[model samples]
Target chain A: MEINGVTIEDTFAEAFKMWGSRLIITAATEQWAMTTAQAATGFGTSIIGCGCEAGIGRVLGVDQTPDGRPGVEVLFFTTSKKSIAPVLLVRVGQCIMTAPTSACFNGLAAEKTVAVGGKLRYFGDGFQSSKLIDGRRFWRVPVMDGEFVIEEEFGMQKSVGGGNFLILAESQTAALEASEQAVAAMRQVPDIIMPFPGGIVRSGSKTSSIYKGMTASTNTAYCPTIRQQVESVLPEGVNSVMEIVIDGLTEGAIAEAMRYGIAAACQPGVVRISAGNYGGTLGQFQFHLKQIMA
Target chain B: MGSQLNSEKTTAVSINDDGVTLRLKAPITLPVEAESICPDCFVGCQQSEILALPVFCGRRRKMLGDIFSVSGEASDRITVEGDLTHFKRIGQGMSRGRLTLRGDGGMHIGAYMKGGEICVEGNTRDWTGAHMTGGMIRIRGNAGHFTGAAYPGEIRGVNRGTIIVHGDVGNETGARMRRGLIVVEGHTGECTGAGMIAGSVFVFGKLGARAGAGNKRGSIVALGETAPMLPTYQYQCRAQFGFLGVYLRQIRKWGIAVSDDLLKGSFRRFSGDVTALNKGEILIHD
Candidate 1:
């Protein structure tokens, strides 16, 4: 299949089940909220190094927030439910709790809960107080600016992670440009986050590595420079490749994001749009490119 | 108090009269514990079974049928049309279903109720909603003292749920409440929210003297004129609280009155009672 003159590869994007939570960070102004959100999600592009993968879900208007301020919704994903609290404790305590005039609230409601402000309240050194409003509990921690209000707990839900699509182009610049456009398009969709720098990952990996001590390594077949030396999957004219990794609260959200990202990546000079998967192994979810495109 | 009931109605209980039909065949000469006459207990009872339920009239164990004339089949929704000023412990421990009281209610109305809802169209005696764990109690008329207050010797009052009083309430409203909300639309008697541990009390009318005297971590929001505060409460800065906007929007959905000024105005924050936990706050609208 082809869209916008770009060929659609007959591959599927493999996604694994993950534990995730959404947080709404509000501040005295939009700038502060965005700053705090960016800080909290920074260095959180991949769980391989960063304890979690996160990205800005959306920018919320005053009416959409609990605190009646300009806010940003962020989605955080971890490999397991047990890891969500520790990851959030570090992210929120260091980033949002330190930002000026910022407050945090749970963006989603689920049966399973993880401590967010409950564990961070100790920063108050026995001075923290809690308030219950409309059946939701909030912790007020004293800070230099007065008090930082954060919700006591956040709801965690079963999520999908590692939903990705590859943009294979005739040149590195063309691949980068198409990936950038795809990222920008995916950002407009809600409940999904591309947890990579500019939502583009150049170092897409395979399931296993040939090297003795490594679990995962680069996809050499897709590497433009090594394509001649190794088994190359790229069509004849394709020279460069980039991938957009997505983590979302639901399968539908990831599917929707993949659809939009692939459509946007099918631009001029782009040779094909493919996805990374291990022949339906090592992952529970599969998003077939043709089905999503159709 | 939580009262659970089956979702499907096996019976239907309704008041047979149009006005305040006296459910009781004769006026009670003594105070009776009418706790059994609630939606939780009558949801699946037949008229004969409802009358056969037990009640205590001043230490005398009497069958409910001997006192009141019940005719409707039992269901989840119960309506009592009568001068229930002699009835006590009505809707107590109710976890589900709806109970409607058409006339005056006696003391301990909805005490320890955990779920469901109680709507009282007439005045109620003291100790309304005492020790209630969940559910909602909406009193359309005046309430006697200790509305939503803790029972005697109990450490907490209403732990969860909401209580809305559209008319005046007597002394110590929300006293010792640990959680949940109490909103009084009219004047509240002296020492309102006294000894409160945590929770919120929103009084839209005149607040009585020494409000929130011994509060620990609760919020006493006085939208109207209030009496003098205790010396233990230290005056803090005035600011517009965003939580009030969220709270007002929620209570408005329940048909509670909210003025525009109260929703948009700044409040003078007073942190107290310093002699106690010193975490409670009194937010007087400025």
Candidate 2:
């Protein structure tokens, strides 16, 4: 099916089950909070290379934050539950803990909690103190500036990842602009993160590698370099393709974001819009492009 | 001093024993009525004057047999001494009962207890005296978090009650505590008196961070330094303040020995937690 001259590829995006956590960080000032949150979530674009995916969810005003200070919410997702703890320990220790006058809390209060601060509390040596407020536990580690308060644990939940859509354009510049608008529209969603390089992945992957041991294969359908040898699925004149992968706690949240992103990416300079699917060979969650668009 | 109830309606109880086990007769259930009697009525309950006494644990839907084991004597006051770590909703909504305990007691020590008293000689657990509209509790040792706080997910705490803790307390001490007085002779834990619309807490020892972090009204007199003073708090001038002595003296009734320097010393008044509504104040006295 096609609309607005952009062919809708009857393909799907294969994703795996991911575990994630959300941390609410606050600092003495809005800038520090934003910087610390951004840093902790930085360098995290995909579980393939970064071991995890993280990002700043939003900037909280003093009136809206837990400690009544300017704060930011961060989302982190991993391929496995076991992998999540280590990545979080290192991230929080190096980023949020090092930031001046910052405090962290579990943004997702799940039935089962994952110990984030509880594991990081050792950084306090022997001076760390803990308190129970409203049934939730929080730890205060003494710092040079004053103190760093963080929740003992953050909530954990199963999520979906690699929920993506690719934008095909005549030029690299056009592909980037469409991807940018799509990313902006996806920002309205919660409990999800765009874990692609610059929120856009130009190199999409296939299920298996031709040379055993390498799990991911290259995308031949949209590969302009292999247009002559392969039965290229790209419409004539298509030169570039960029994908946007999403990780989220719930399927609906990801679907909502995908819809907004596709609508934005379908703007000018975009030749076609399609998803990278594994022929329903992966997890149960599937995003039918037409159904979502409709 | 966690007490369970069994056939409380017909049971004869009087306590003057050195050691007795009043295990909560019920697990995961409301505390027995024996917990509701006044500190004074406890004398009658212990005196075997159950017929003449106007006291019991309180009113609940279950039977006393559902919660406790009463194998001790009938007397004027009973000493309950044992491991009471998991007890909860005890002495709730009590008005009068003279109960003595050598061990810790659980939440809601005297919930809405209008005219009674409960004395705990050891550490008391969280939610102690929570949402207590009235009554008095004298704790000889440290108390866990949320002492005199509102019920879980509730809006206000301890509309009126007198809670004296000889030892330190946890976060949100007297949280949302409205009209009442809480005196802590020892150090107080973090966020003491947070989100309190009214009330007062006089801490004699070192206090934890964010004391009175979100108070619309009430007074928190700090005798020692608390690290991590809330950024919301603004530093005011330091000067001699006699009111500090009065509060210290009031807690002296709880066996907290104090010197005169605290009451007659210079204090620093900083108003804040400006982060919220910016109404809380910390009076740091030297």
- Give the DockQ (2 decimals) of all models: 0.37, 0.05
Candidate 2 local lDDT, B92-144, one digit each (tens): 66554456666777665666656456788888878777887766788888888
What is the Cα-based lDDT of residue A91 in candidate 1?
A: 92
Native interface contacts kept by each candidate, as a fraction:
0.31, 0.00
- CAPRI class of candidate 2: incorrect
| Candidate-wise lDDT, in order | 0.87, 0.72
On DockQ, the leading prediction is 1
TM-score of chain B in each prediction: 0.91, 0.75
| Candidate 1 ranges with C-alpha deviation above 4 Å | A207-218, B1-30, B56-72, B242-246, B259-264
TM-score of chain A of 1: 0.98
For residues A1-294, write the lDDT of model 1, one tens digit per residue: 999989898889999999999999988899999999999999998888788999998899977888677899999999999999999999999999999989999999999999888899899997787777667988888788767889999999999999999999999999999999899889888999999998999998875787897877899989989888998898899999999999999999999999989998999999999898888978999999999999
Q: List RMSD in Å for every model shown.
A: 3.8, 14.3
Worst 10 residues of 1 chain B by lDDT: B13-22
Q: On residues B146-239, what C-alpha lDDT tens digit does candidate 1 reach at each position? A: 9999977888788988999999999999999999899998999999998999989999889899899899988999999988888999998887
